[model samples]
Target: MTAPTPAAGAPDRAAPPGRPDGTERARGIRGVQPVAPLLGVLALGVCLVTSLDVVTAAVALGIEVALLPLLRIPPRTLLLRTSPVLVAVPLTAISIALYGRPSGRHWFDLGPAHVTDGSLTLALATALRVLAVGLPAVVLFIRVDPTDLADGLAQLLRLPARFVLGALAAVRMMTLLGEDWRQLGMARRARGVADTGRLRRGATMAFALLVLALRRATTLAVAMESRGFGAPGRRTWARTARFAGPEWAMVGVLVGIGVVSISVAVCAGTWRA
Candidate 1:
């Protein structure tokens, strides 16, 4: 094999001169990228408070307070664009409220679990905690282009390259599936099969899409294996994570959130046995 010469002024060009490998080029992600400090703080709040750590929860909420200004994201745009996150945030709250451990003085006695002022208060706290924790994570996910995330995870966290990059490729395929799903829905409607009969046909189509998605996932996994995506050798990261001061700042933010969440819960008299 002959060593390929770089194309005129294009240092990273893979093939004959000006041509570059698709993976070699940097891809732009959607939304404003967050500094590592912010994400660190928010994610830490979620992880730390998960163990009912009041200090951690309080710190997480504090970061959220600080982030309201830091994020510069418009409210209308935030609500409309981040609709998925909005849905997720509350759903998470409901889950926590329903599943959280019941404690405190009993206010109303029910058949099984009594609904007490303490329980209501606990539920609200849990719900708030979930809402606070989930929104940032979801927002961050929205802003993070999967490619950048994959690169960052692999290079910064020293994640397994095969797993990280393979997942990134899979993320790209979802765009195709999104279109495929719309077309499938339209085709069913065109065939007069979309009306509400014994349950909506659209629901059936949606189920079919689920199966198709699972099938596609399995197929993609196999295809990746065949295409040397998993060939066991040293892999070089095309993009590197530049850990500036911001990254370390993110770590501190997480620690701060963890401490605060623990403290707040304890002070609020919401800590359970």
Candidate 2:
């Protein structure tokens, strides 16, 4: 008996060979249109809390945490993605406490590096504010596909088509560089290269990767130019990027969070700046 083939233009029954399906990619707020405005809001929030306002930072962080469920980002995935920032926050706080400008009552004196009440407060505020700002940005950007970001930049922001497409291409290549580096290491191992002399081997591998990257970049530039990327004619987008009510609403929600946080801090007399 002959099996039936998929009809022309019909959706495939199976997922692509190695790529995740749309469901996996669509977990969070999965578009760049909303992210653009959300980013602006976060930037403004960063500025508002830059004066070491601990109460404001805490409130903003609480609000951001409350909104996390709406983004549909898995807690484990989010932690893994933002682990660097999470680790750095404490280290930064410690540095600020140890070496920051001295003010208020002295807490500890270690020669030139002194810890004061003001320095400690500033350190806590700095760490919390970084979390408040960085967490949301990380979560939002994870859901944004490079193609969607390119579309949003070109369509919504009116950026030059060539620049946006070039950025997209570069971002796509970076994701593969890790695998390429791993393969290069494996090749060296198979060739019986001794792992002694770390500096020499690292320099050689880096030079090889640089040469490969330059060649790939040259090829990409040629291909893009051949397709009339930098031409003077009016260009059209393959996908529509909308900045509509939903995008505006997301920005408004973020703005409200910032305002409420500041107001609470001010009323409670914790807003030092």
Candidate 3:
């Protein structure tokens, strides 16, 4: 197996990464279990309330925002995690604005695309809903190491141990994907084959990365099997993943936010089917 390389633009490992505030907060919340279940509950609530309840969506988003400061998530890390929403939410909202169920006063029309009060309302709700659903999961997971997460899943969730560990190993290699890509680019440049069409170069690099990943996966599997990993039997966890009071409180808070938001929307007569 090739030695692993650091990602080209990753921060140096001189000291532990993460902001002081975030690291401190992580200490308090680090070893909890049922992390996925909490996030799933929040996501399900967002889906139920977002379609025709703009007020509920907005309230839920506000609750999530408030929780961010409590979590002490640094701005840089938060930005990195939530950047996908910046692109995806707008595109999704635009599509809804242009082609959603038309009602109320018409705003504009272009070919098959049309905008109206109802669609514009839906667009705003959709954007808020995405933020409400996505931000919490990202913030919560920023401190979760993949190996620990897999352990939690296998133990608390009673998932297959071998599969969970294997998936965890794959996730741990994600940073290597970037490192490998950078190395490949450098190698190509050295061979005087770098100055090619951008699309073609990208395709070649991607294919090489895929092959590298497959090789690494094979090596990893062999190593694990050699250590009695795939044997069907009970396994012991080095660290216990407990879903105690704090974890339950966290889940309850999120559920309460969803319930309260929906109730308020219903009372305000803004809750639509």
Candidate 4:
């Protein structure tokens, strides 16, 4: 047989030296099943919620911060996504410090509100706990695609397909809410109703948005039902959601962090329940 000649413009499939191939590159945490991170977050939250100790929350928060580099999130994006938590933590701490159960020496006092040593400590713990739990969740979810999550829930977790798909649709629709609100505002301005009282304009816009959302939901339900999504038969998934070694390892790491945090708090005698 004659040897075949190379075709013109054929691309090479081989990876360059010291560089990862497509499959190797896809092996990062981003490629793991979505359920793994979801369960991991839940486990971490459960572990932290069991105690109201500064030690546990602080330890967990420290570990989470250390792992931030591995998540490969840009600093600006991380800050923006986690801004809500950052703002909320201070508010939560302030509220708790002022109104929390008082014990030990009092630092400040007002009508039905006191900032004591114990209350301050409790407030700090609560704030840290919220940060520890919320930070990782926001970061992890930033990488999770809604479709992938729905697939994982339906296939790997054995959840009802209808529920998973419905939730996924709802998530997808949430992104449109900003655009919808903008359009509603423009319409109101065109109709000369938006230049009035700010509160009244906001109230009217909110009601309109609510009505639009309900209408969208009804239309979507009808469309989905028409497409046989509401059928009670076995459904085949387009992608297989695998819960293999990597997913297990991710879950294990989160669980280990939780256990160590709890253990440290217990040993330090700071654990409260």
TM-score: which candidate is best? 2
> What overall lDDT goes with each candidate model?
0.62, 0.79, 0.78, 0.89
lDDT of 4 by residue, 141-202 (tens): 88777877888889988998989999999999999999999999999899988897999889
Between the candidate structures 2 and 4, which one is better when assessed by TM-score?
A: 2
Worst 10 contiguous positions by lDDT, candidate 2: 18-27
Off by over 4 Å in 4: 1-28, 184-208
How far in Å is the alpha carbon of 39 misplaced in model 3? Answer: 4.1
* lDDT of model 4, residue 88: 99
Count backbone overlaps in model 4. Answer: 0
Two-way TM-score contest, 1 vs 3, winner: 3
**TM-score of every model versus the real structure:** 0.65, 0.83, 0.81, 0.82
Per-prediction RMSD in angstroms? 6.8, 4.3, 8.5, 5.9
What are the per-residue Cα lDDT tens digits for candidate 3 across 114-218? 899989999998888877777775667777667667767888888899889888888888879888999999999999999978899999999999999999999
TM value for model 4: 0.82
Rank by lDDT, highest first: 4, 2, 3, 1
Q: Which stretches of candidate 1 lie over 4 Å from their true place?
A: 1-43, 46-63, 80-104, 188-200, 203-227, 260-273
Candidate 1's C-alpha lDDT? 0.62
Q: For residue 239, give model 2's deviation from the true position in Å.
A: 0.8
Name the 10 consecutive residues with the lowest summed lDDT in model 3: 19-28
- Note the residue pairs that clash in candidate 3: none
Order of the predicted models by TM-score, top scorer first: 2, 4, 3, 1
TM-score of model number 1: 0.65
Model 4, residue 12: what's the lDDT?
55
